[model samples]
Target: MLQSPVEFFRTLPKKVCPECGEHIQEQAESYLFECERCLANKEE
Candidate 1:
């Protein structure tokens, strides 16, 4: 069976930041999964 890209993504669970438990808004292609705030903090 084949699934459309949109359908495949919709079936996946939402991503959350491991550090803060905040919902992640990054795209699926993002190499890092952390949310923006956590990523910024880690870079400091």
Candidate 2:
């Protein structure tokens, strides 16, 4: 189990949003691998 917040974050695969330069958390592949905001707009 994770021992702290820093350790938890260190385990995640985070990257900058290609469109907006915002930090994005990498989620599961089935979740679409996109910027949260961009993905929302794309669905609209």
**Which numbered prediction scores highest in lDDT against the true structure?**
1
All candidates' lDDT scores? Answer: 0.83, 0.72
CA shift at 42, candidate 2, in angstroms?
0.7
Which 10 successive residues of model 2 have the least lDDT summed? 25-34
lDDT of 1: 0.83
Best by TM-score: 1
List model 1 lDDT by residue over 1-44, tens digit each. Answer: 99999999789888788899988876646867788888788899
Off by over 4 Å in 2: 1-14, 27-33
lDDT of 1 at 8: 96
Residue-level lDDT for 41 in candidate 2: 82
Instruction: Kindly report which residue stretches of model 1 are placed more than 4 angstroms away from their true locations once superposed.
Output: 1-6
- Pairs with steric clashes in candidate 2: none
